[model samples]
Target: MRFDTRLVHAGHELAEGTGDVVPPLHLASTYAHGVQDPPAYFYARGENPTREALERALAALEDVRFATVFASGQAAGATALATLAGAGRVIVSDDVYGGTYALLTSSRLDVRPVDLADPAAVADAFADPWAAEALVWVETPTNPMLKVADLAEVCRRAHARGCLVLVDNTLAGPALQQPLRWGADVTLCSTTKSVAGHLDVLGGALVHDRADLHDLFTTHRTTTGSVPSPFDSFLVHRGLKTLSLRTARQVETAGKLASALRESPHVAEVRYPGLPGHPGHEVAARQMSGFGSVVAFRYRADVAGLLRRSRYFADAVSLGGVRSLAQCPATTTHRPIPPDVRLRLGITDDLVRLSVGIEDPEDLLEDLLQALSPS
Candidate 1:
């Protein structure tokens, strides 16, 4: 079956008692395991029916055999990275989410920040003999930057060097891209984003192709107690049903916005994989079936004027929500990082990132036109 078709059907079993079409949420903290037939669910921390249903659906979406859920994307990412503890080194993308950068740098592993998008640069990062045991963390259509990484190349080189590769598929979402098929050992995503769609729930997911790695992540998740609640899991399960349609609408709007923004004289630069001039356009086209909603562009003039004049977008931080959002990454999302680090990353004060929504394309375009009139 096609992806959209499978999305609606996969991992969904009829509710046992009432024969409900959707899987019923099981909220029990602990389940009874009979002597005659032991139930698969035992405890909330170890496992839960609601969370398992979401995990199974996620696993199927990413074409993987196993998946685990977490309270937040950070928890999922941290737990997945923790699996590389005691390894000689870990390589991370320089422009990844600020939270991810903090988690890796402060950890026991020698985290090395590099441009994982550049296969050669990543290969050079592991030049040292100890790096043979390294782990690589990547993000394509990276946070705020909208840069696409060559996950396939990174996975190929890492696997050849006997290193594990974990690709954060948050920005593109599994609806657009699947890193595992590109040879990545594992895939990470913030289900809170496009997966949950409504912005009402927060959740994270880790998908692994290898059994041993899946077991390792499950153990870490259980030990650290970083799993998501049953209710949140249930919400995300419902969200998955509309992910395809929501993402498609948002992606279309984003493409139009990126094009319109480029025509404005106030805009200095536009960063979007869908843009022809973008460095990663070809790579993104090769790996992803669709370009995501988020768009980043540089506005040399005062952003406060732009923000105030805007009538539609909420001046907010989070992305992949049903409503449009706009934010200055330097002040909001990447504020934790030093000014110099952000500058080097091209996250300037004048830069604005837009998370386009499922709203009408004309409405969003008019909002941008009026708000950006001064630009």
Candidate 2:
């Protein structure tokens, strides 16, 4: 079946007890076990019916063998990285996404920062002396900057070196891009964003094509005890039903906003894959079905003053929600990383990451213009 059709009817069926159209939420923490041996579910930590149903649906959506839901995106990321790295191993990653960066640096795992957009640099990093037991973690159309990485090339190189490849599919979400199809061993996503749509729940998931990796992630889920609650899982499933529709509208709005920002005198630069002249436009066009909902732009004048004057764009954290949000990465998201390091990664002080919502295009444009203009 097509993606949109699958989204609405993939994992849900009529309830056995009431014949309800929606899947019933099993909130009980523990399930009854038989005398000899229990069925698939024994306890909430291990599995629950509601969570399992959502997991199966997500796996089907991503075309993966298994899917494990987590309490948050960071938990899923940590679990996947820990499973791949084991212990006392190096991880090569692009200097993006503050939460992921914190996890990599805080843990005992050794991390090597590299320019993911350049395949040659990634290859060199993998061949370096510190790469003895290394894994490659990539985030395409990377956070804040919207820099696109060549996933297929990187996966080929990493696999050739007997290394695991983990791609964070949060920014593009599974509706637009699937990393496993590009040869990635595992795909990670923060359902709190586009997948949840409503911004009402915080959740994460890991999908993989390999059975061994799937089993390993499942083991990690059980040991780490970071599985999502039954209600959160249900909400994620409900949000998934409208994923394609919401994303399609968001894409259209983001494209218009990016184009308008580029033409405005108060904007220094607009970074969006959907834009014709964006550096990674070709790569994104090849890999993703849609250009996604996020757009980043730099201010030509007083950034602080403009933000203060802005009425519609809320200066807030997190993206991929139904509400539009504007954030200053240098101060909010990427503050933990050094200033020089952020600059090296092409994340500037004036950069404003805009998460376009399903709002009217004209209203959003007017708000932006008023904010950019001097009061």
Candidate 3:
């Protein structure tokens, strides 16, 4: 079946007993055992019919053997890293996505941040003597900056050293790019963002082609009790039905916004892989079916003043929702990192990351123009 059809019908087997068209929510914490041995579900932490259905659907969508859902994106990321890396093992990652940086750096785990734009730097980071058992975690069209990484090459180099490669596909959802197909062992995402699309629920997921890794992550999830509620799982599945349509609208709006920002006087640099002059444009075009919905740009003047003047774009946190969001990363998201590190990664105080919504493109453009205009 095609992607859109799969999105709606993949894991949903209509109720055999009740003939319910929509999947029913299994709310019980524990399931009754009919016989001496027990049913598939014993406890909520271990399993639920609704959550399992969603997991199976996501695994099918990503073309992976297995998938596991988590309470949040960070939980999925941390679990994947923790399950893969042991004591003193190193992690090489891009200094993008504030939540990821916080998880890697603040945790007891050893990590080395690298400039993802430079493939040589990444290769060198892996070659360092301290990285003997390293795992490479990449976020392509990386958060805030939208920098692209050559996934196939990175995976090849990392695998040569026996290091696992995991890609955070939150920015470019499974609809746009599939990291496992490009050679990543694991692909993780904050389903709350693009997959859920409504911003009403919080969920995370990990999809893996390797059965061993999938089993390990699934074990970790059950033991750790980081699984999402059945209601959340049902909501995400409902949201998945329209993922393609919403993403198409988001991509269109983002392109319009990127062009508008580039031509504006207050804007100094527009960082979007879709833009022709963007450093990673060609690489993004090669890997992704469509450039994602997020765009980041820096201003020539007072960023706070500009954000304050906006009516349409909310100065908010989180991305990939149906409503537009604008945020200053230097203060809101990337503030945990040192100023110098953020500067090196091109996350400046004047920068604004915009999560373009499914709203009318002309309305978005008008709101942005007013926001960027001098207050």
Write one digit per residue (lDDT tens) for candidate 1, span 1-375.
578876787787787678878878888898777842656777889988788888888888877788888999999988887775447588788898877877776777787788876667877876757667688888888998987888777877777778888889999899999999999878889999999989899999888867887788889989999989889998998999999999999999999999999998889999989999999999999999888999999986899889888888999888898999998988888888788989998988999999998989999999998898773
Q: What stretches of model 3 exceed 4 Å from their correct place?
A: 35-38
Clashes of each: 0, 0, 0
Which should have the higher TM-score, number 2 or number 3? Answer: 3
RMSD per candidate (Å) reads: 1.5, 1.8, 1.6
Model 2 C-alpha lDDT per residue in residues 1-375, reported as the tens digit of each score: 677877877777777779978789899888676742737677789878888888878888876668888999999988877788954565555657988888888988767777778767877876766665567788887998888888898888777777788899899998999998899888899999999988799999988877888788888988989999999999999998899989998999999999999999888889999998987899899999999999999897777887788777788888888888898898998887788888887788888899998888789889998898865
Colliding pairs, model 2: none
Candidate 1 residue 226 C-alpha distance from true site, Å: 1.0
Top-down TM-score ranking: 1, 3, 2
- What are the TM-scores, per candidate, against the unseen true structure? 0.96, 0.95, 0.96
Candidate 2 lDDT score relative to the true structure: 0.85
